[model samples]
Target: MLLTIEDLTKTFPGTVALDGVCFDLRAGEVHALLGENGAGKSTLVKCLTGVHARDSGTIWLEGKEISPASTLEAQEAGIGTVYQEVNLLPNLTVAENLTFGRQPTRFGMVSGRKMRAEAEAMLAGYGLDHVNVTRELGTYSVAVQQIVAIARAVALSGKVLILDEPTASLDARETETLFQVVRGLRERGLGIVFISHFLDQVFEISDRLTVLRNGRHITTADTAGMDRLELIHHMLGHELEEAEGRRRHRQGGVERLQVRGLARRGKIEPFDLTVREGEVIGLAGLLGSGRTETADVLFGRTPPDRGDATDADGPIDLRTPRTAIAAGFGYAPEDRKTDGVIADLSVRENIALALQARRGWTKPIPRAEQRRLANDYIRRLDIRTPGAEKAVGDLSGGNQQKVVLARWLAMNPRFLILDEPTRGIDVGAHAEILKLIGELTAQGMSILLISSEFDELIAASDRVIVVRDRRHVSELVGEEIETGRIIDAIAAHENGEGAMTP
Candidate 1:
């Protein structure tokens, strides 16, 4: 083994991020670390790369125990990491970014010529000879920047290269280009750790797999014999049971929203959808599959270039967020921190935002009415707040999410769009959010629920639309929706077979 870990563990306030996690990698093999968000994959990686100190565990490289004290120390120990977003300085030239701190010096003067020469030679080895070393890195396409990042990392003393979501933003050709570079590294006997949410890519590139769930290692298996269904089951930790008492909320009704040719430039391809009242239509796919993009268009967060939406009333143009709000649409975006709440304000103030917007600023919502609205929803949603007067920023993640929901609920929306409502929240909070979905839909609210977790979508949705490459490819409904089929559908898309269901 080139690298081995035994009983690695890490903890943070109110949660254990990693519990007795163990994994290993061999020279010349691509080892994949697989998990959903908050599954301790990041924590374990951080521990190995010295971004966080582990509470307990042992790491061995070449049969010798070694603890990397920092990122610099990790690099010196022959482990180098490249993140999802290329972290190289965009302001600098490709050569400058590549040789940032290690510029050759002659008489204590920096040597630009030496740096560019070294960078050009390194890039040529990775089939990136077309990239001008003297040009600013930001001027290159994302794919070119990614190759530059990999070249720089491998040029350093990197015995083990960690590529985290390296091909996330690349197109098909770009991804193939990256794979060629990776294969070459593998041939050079360098251990590689690849972390990504794409199942097909993992099976295509990895030699072995390690699964993590709820901050603990579930299982590890060689890729040759393992099937995709088994792998998804290991990651999700669930089996499909009869949808009996659990599915009481699906009230059949007429369509409440009809969107035709809705799309934004370079965000999502044009798509059509019909969502009826009391229906939970789940948008299912991996990350960057246009789930959030679809929701953004529906809610007017990202205005559509060419599209028309209609309720039973008439043709409606969602040109902006306020238009969406006025038309009885509610959207709780995926990211709650940057887009959702006014952290500095009181809970009462945050919850009252939407309704006040509807009422207009001149006719400010009465202070007493705002307090009543806040208290009612705080109890209705069971938001854990010190008081309605407490700053929303001071609350836990789950509570902060509730406050965002309350803001929309206050407006009495006819259509609601929720993107990843259960992500990054505690387990207890997850259950509560799921239950609330059932209650809201049972009471005749229409919803478009988007999530990456297949089980959550299967358990709560009336229809699950499988999206791939920013387009809706297939769908599954009651009695037909299972984990295996969903995995197959996703795989089918990758292999160019996913299409409209018969």
Candidate 2:
């Protein structure tokens, strides 16, 4: 092993972020760090990068113990990291960026000619020699910028490279180009840490993988031997629960929401759906499969180019957020930090936000009423908070998510859409949120649920709607609902075959 970590542990206030995590990286292999959100993946990376001090651990590089007090020290010790977002100066030329602050100098002046010549040579090793080194980095695509960033990292610190979600913003062609560059680096014997949520890419690129759960390492093994299901099982710490009996769960009689040809070009293909009261429609798909797009269109976050939505009163506008709210629709978005929660606001304010929007701004809910509603739901939803005045951002991830749920539930929506509702929260909170969904549906509220976990989806949904490539493929109900069936529906290249339509 070129780099080894033994019994690494880190703790923060009220939580153990990492405990006895052990991992090793070989010189010429790609080691993937795999885990769901808040599974200590970030904490371990921070520890290695010296962003946080480890409580107890031993890190050895080439059989010598070295503790990096800061990122600069880590870079000096041959550890380099490239995050999802490119950090290089886009306005500068590729050559200038690669040699930033340390440009070749002659007679006490920077020499562009010297810098370009060296930078061109360095980028050549990363399969980017054809790119004009003198051109502004922004002139090229994001994929090109990433290659330039990697080249600069190797030029400064050559031993190890950490690629964090490198393909997130890339297209298939761009991802292939980046993968080629990574392969070249591996051939040259530099240990590479590949971190990504895309399981397909992990199996395609990583030589070995280490699964982390709840701040502890589960296992590390060669990628060739493990299938996607097995890898997910290891990361989730169990196999998905069988959905044998729940397929017969009956939907309420009243039709709550009706959609016909709802879609935006290049976002989602035209699709039709009917949500009866008390029904949970689970959207099953991999990332980029238009799950979020459907939710956005329904909630009026993105107005569809073409669609018709209706309630019992007949046609209603699906044109804006205000209309969606007026029509008794609520949404809890996937990225709670950005789209869902008002972090700076107090818990009471966050919970009262949707209601305020529903009721015109001039007619403010009284402070006494606000306090009572916030306190009532806080107790009802089990949101851990000191008081209604406490900042929602100060609470734990689970509590923040609960606050978002409380906001929608307070509005008493007829239809609710929850995208990745259980994400980034602890197991206990996840269960509570699921249970909350069950309670809501029991009260005859229609729900559109999106989750990566198949077990939860199968367990909660009356019918599973499968989407792929921005199109609805199939729908499953009754005895057809199961993890295996949903996986097949998601994986089925063409629609209809092996896909149960209702």
Candidate 3:
């Protein structure tokens, strides 16, 4: 084994972030660390990299007991980490950023020529010669930046490389390129720890899998013997009997919201979809399959090239989020930390933010009234915070998500677009969120739900729309919306074949 972690434990103020987690990584293996948000996956990674010292654990690197007290120590000991956010300096050229601390110098002077040459050579090894090493790193797209980060980490000569959601912002072609690089790394005998929400990518690349739930080690097994549903069940901590029971109630009603010829150039293709008034509609596809893109168009994040939405009220022109809001549309974006919540603001301020924005900043809602509204939501949604005065950032991941939902719930929208609403939350929180969606739909609200979890999409949505290659390729309703069918449709489209529709 390249690395072994035994009985690792970590605790924060009110939470046990990691509890006796054990795992092993082998050379020439891609091990996927799977879990929902706040499930100790992050803690495990931090512990491995020395970002957070573990409370108790035994870490053996190449059969030698080592406790790295800092990230630099971990790096020197041949352990590297590439986080979700790009850590390279934006102002510096790619070459300089890659060799930031350990620059090749001669006679106490940095060798720019050597740096550029080495950087270019390293990038070329990963099929990234198209990106100029001398150019500013920020000028390139996120995919290119990610590649640079990975290249830098590998160039550190690390025996184990930890990639945390490296492909979250990457497109289809970019993800393919990354997979190739990962395969190459595995071939070179590097133990890679892949962390991602995209299960298909996890299955495609990972040789072994370790699942964490609520800061506890759940299971570790070979990827080849495990199925998608089983992996999800492990991550969710759902009993087989409970899942079977839920599966029986999957089928629901007719179309509530209908979209025809929905198109957005360079975003999504002309698509058709429908969701019943009392039903949840799921958009399932790969990273750039236009799932979130379609949600953007529907919820007025972006203007569609040419498309129309028909609801009980009538056909509506959703040109912008303001117009969509006025037409009774609500949107909860994917990244709650960035797009959904205001970290600096109090819970009251954050919860009333959307309503206040819709009302226009000039005509502000009275502070007293805003407090009242916030308090009501806090009570209704069971938002866990000290008080309405607490900063939104101070709350737990699940609680912060609740505040985001409360913001939209205050709008009383007819149609709600939830883009990865349950992402980065625990199983209990996910269940609560899903239950809330079901409750809203039962009360005559139409919803467009998008999730990376196939089972979550299938379980919560009454109908499913599969997008592939930035286009809506298939629609499955009622009995047709099964995991196997959805996976088949997505795989078919991904491999250059059109999705089979029903």
Q: In TM-score terms, which candidate is top?
A: 3
RMSD of each: 7.4, 6.5, 5.6
Quantify all predictions' global Cα lDDT against the true fold: 0.80, 0.82, 0.80
Per residue, candidate 1 scores C-alpha lDDT tens digits across 289-401 of 78888888888888999878998999877988899888888898866857889899999999999889888988999999999999998887667665799888766445777
Model 2 alpha-carbon miss at residue 315, Å: 3.1
lDDT of 3 by residue, 415-477 (tens): 888887765454445666777776777787878888877778888877788888887777887
Cα lDDT tens digits, model 2, 360-430, are 89999998888999998888766766688988776655577788878888998999988877654544445
What is the alpha-carbon lDDT of model 3 when measured against the actual structure?
0.80
Candidate 3 vs. truth: CA RMSD? 5.6
List the candidate 2 regions with Cα displacement exceeding 4 Å: 1-41, 52-72, 82-248, 346-352, 360-406, 423-432, 452-456, 482-502
Residue 406, candidate 1: alpha-carbon lDDT:
84
Kindly report which residue stretches of model 3 are placed more than 4 angstroms away from their true locations once superposed.
Answer: 4-9, 19-24, 53-60, 63-69, 89-93, 104-113, 129-144, 167-177, 196-213, 217-276, 279-294, 303-320, 344-352, 355-406, 422-436, 451-502
Q: List the residue pairs that clash in candidate 2.
A: none
How many Å off is the CA of 112 in candidate 3?
6.0
Colliding pairs, model 1: none
What C-alpha lDDT, on a 0 to 100 scale, does residue 29 get in candidate 2?
Answer: 95
